[model samples]
Target chain A: MYGGGGGHYDGGGGAANANSLFGGGGFMPSQSTAAPESSGGGSLSKVGPERADAAAAHREADHGRGAASDDKSNFAINSVEVSTIRLVGRMLGKVERVTDVAFILDDGTGKIDVNRWENESSDTKEMADVNDGNYVIVNGGLKGFQGKRHVVAYSVRRVTNFNDITHHFLHCIYVHLELTKSNSRLPSQINASTGIPGHANQVRLPNNQATTFSASGNTAGNDVSSLVMSVFHDPAIIDREDGITVAYIIDRLKLPEEVIKEVMQKHIDDGNIYNTIDDLHYRSAMNG
Target chain B: MDTSSPAAIVNGEILNKFVGRRVRTVVQVQRNEGGMVFGQSTDGHQLTIKSAMDIPVSHFMEVYGIAEHNQTIRAEVCTDFGPNFDAKAFDGLCKLANDKFKHLFL
Candidate 1:
């Protein structure tokens, strides 16, 4: 009996064919019939904002890395090829049992089979209790067998608040944009002069678009980096929940795309931003 | 009107055109508090709603509002849709979000 907006649920069945492995019938686990262990949507209030805050911290800590490989299990829906992937979604069907019980997880955009092997001593009890039509977060590696994608879950937890689903999707969009839009620049010498730890790596500049601070000197590159940082820190740009895009930067700052790309590359190099769902999108490292 | 059609404004640039105009669009509520709700449109634009109405999190709405300064909108009216709200029409919207939008995740 959820209420607030007085409308109806219209689930259009026409989704792009989800990358689900099976159409139906594989293995049905012994049904847990347990009333879902719910937290009454308590996480709803706080989860959304935490994404930006945490992403900011994540960017700061891994300023020079190409990917968060060490945290590879932190998977999202589009990360199907990344072996170390983690995700959360709704359970689509009755638990299926084979050598290991499998639960089909649907996260709107895609679907993947998550297996809970009988052989493992990891958190099986909690996963076993998850019911169909409930939300869940899974941590695991992506796998391919017989041309289908599968996930061998390291952990699965019931999602109490529905907001987490939206939050997860937004986070994904944020990452995709950051990964694709920001570019790396030649490491600047300003860090040594300013004494900021990893400052060269931290100085991500939209080198081409940052002509506003044009002062001819060896420090021109550093000024460009500062300009790019200003773009990210702009409250009007940062406040949007959808994050920022390269096109938006180009239009708002009257900067050229080539210039934007260079700054984006610089951001990527400094770990200030990473590509989001695709290459064109980006968010600030501070709000990563 | 087909509410299911893909939004023309796929990104933030749409906001520039909508400012000062009363427009109708579908949005998925990300957070709502203190007479304001932050949301993202299906085509990938950020939306901030300021309204006297109560807006719930994780629900979709066919919102008629005026785009104020920045990415924010001052809502004139918001029509909610989903399982607990309008069961007749929102099932498709809800399903579409869960199926396609998941890729936005990392």
Candidate 2:
């Protein structure tokens, strides 16, 4: 997937996997043509009872965390929820061995060591030029040997687009929030329809009752929800389609972070507003 | 826990903190060996998993591990899922993603 990134776009292939994090952003018009039939039946029925048990456990853990507990998946890269991480950062240092390459990468937030096991290929010669201070993206599995966290990079490439680093950070966060907050917490109404975990499934809200942010007997909660939504109306914040981060919402609403988190969670549960780019950032589901 | 900001951290950032502590996080499998697995967050941050039995990726799992440097995590406990994806919990995510990433889509 790493090496094919460039050629995949050039080939203009019909995206069989439209849900691909990197490829199928709204940027492409072909996304709608992705196979919708797969979104349906037989596959879900097979999982049966096992799926239910997992659902219960996931909810239990989430509820136990209560409202707004940093929810570790909050970071973008951390949120991809994969066993392997693909990181793009500046190389702080490097140590090259006959059979492997190791480098320390500082992505500004933190630093981690990346180790690349060299296979006999012409590619090994190309890596020799990857000296310290070179900005490169490393894709590898996480390995811990001798009490240290290291990225075992299977592929490392120099990033030609400088903006891609910043974009990668934001994109990682965006996808993570979308996956963790919005994707994992589907309303029961919608959950009943599709058996697959949140893949383009829609919860049919009651007829024409698009604005479901009703007074669910919690006036304060409803007020905060409205306030949260109102901020998007401000051209400045809403203008950036990425939506506003929870921090920005906290600043503008002048509400306690916990209170804001609780309100936001409630809205997501009730389907009032949906997480836009990332869970920390959000926008109204009305448009969705 | 302070809720003032999003306390998001990469698995690497928190590895040292969990060295001797009992910590829990949701993990997805990338590879499996008899009684051990290479797992990561849904986002692909890596961690090691050790168990008495070979656990496949199909099982949705929540793992508790004692963070160690050499192995990162020795899976002390695991909760399994019969199905891979949790639809009820993730529908909002799919709906939000229905449209590609676009400002107007919001």
For all candidates, the clash counts are 54, 28
Candidate 2, residues A175-223, lDDT tens digits: the string is 2322233323334432232222232133332101112122213323225
Question: What is candidate 1's DockQ?
Answer: 0.03
User: Against the hidden true structure, what lDDT does model 2 obtain?
Assistant: 0.40
Write candidate 1's Cα lDDT for A1-288 as tens digits: 000011101112101111111100011000111112221211111111111101210011111111122333321211111233335555766475644667776543345567866554434455565788666665444444443345676455665433444334444333333322221212242222322234335433222112211111224433444455455545455545556677777776566789877866645543344344456666543331
Candidate 1 Cα RMSD after full superposition onto the native fold (Å): 20.7
lDDT of 2 at A62: 17
Tell me the TM-score of each prediction against the true structure: 0.33, 0.31
- Candidate 2 Cα outliers beyond 4 Å, as residue runs: A1-81, A186-288, B1-106
> Positional deviation of A126 in candidate 2, in angstroms?
3.7
